[model samples]
Target: MADDPTKKGPADRTRVSTSEAHELRYWSEKFGVSHDELKRAVAAVGNSAEKVEAYFRDRSRDARR
Candidate 1:
């Protein structure tokens, strides 16, 4: 592996379509959640970043109710 596997490559796509390890880590940090949670959101919302974000946003909103 390279010295920094998390470093994004030139072709690295968005996390939605290809949940690469680095992208997963980035999403996890960006969302302040675990990898599993991010995966769950993706799974629940079919890998659209907007949908996944909305899923979590709605989930959090529901939790606050």
Candidate 2:
């Protein structure tokens, strides 16, 4: 996926909160992924929240390198 952080529109930005950011950070750390990778996975999964969660759960074992 592309690395454009601006891909999400302004309205979409409002959907995330500080707490959510912290949560994402925690998950990213636990899963051994960059925050950007977590964001990309979420974006790729779109509205499917389950798929987004599953992506992290399934990929956590893979080394980042």
Candidate 3:
């Protein structure tokens, strides 16, 4: 069967945490955004991966406008 396009893969998911250099580096590279951005997103929302992803998603949508 074909992959379910509606389901986001693990890589697309954001795992949030405070700036531990290696973890920060990992997430920054994972999301294709900088540490500051990720940190800000985590601050704005708590460190739930799904919330962080939604934060970025909303930011991206706003940016497109």
- Please give the lDDT score at residue 46 for candidate 2: 55
Q: Give lDDT per model, in order.
A: 0.69, 0.54, 0.69
For model 2, residues 1-30, the per-residue Cα lDDT tens digits are 233345332233323211255555554664
Candidate ranking (lDDT, best to worst):
3, 1, 2
Cα-based TM-score, every candidate: 0.72, 0.42, 0.70
Candidate 1 per-residue C-alpha lDDT over 34-65 given as tens digits, one digit per residue, 9 for 90 to 100 = 89988878887787667877888899999999
For model 1, state the Cα shift of residue 61 in Å: 0.3
Worst 10 residues of 3 by lDDT: 1-10
lDDT of 3 at 24: 64
Inter-residue clash pairs, candidate 1: none
Better of 1 and 3 by lDDT: 3
Report backbone clashes per prediction. Answer: 0, 0, 0
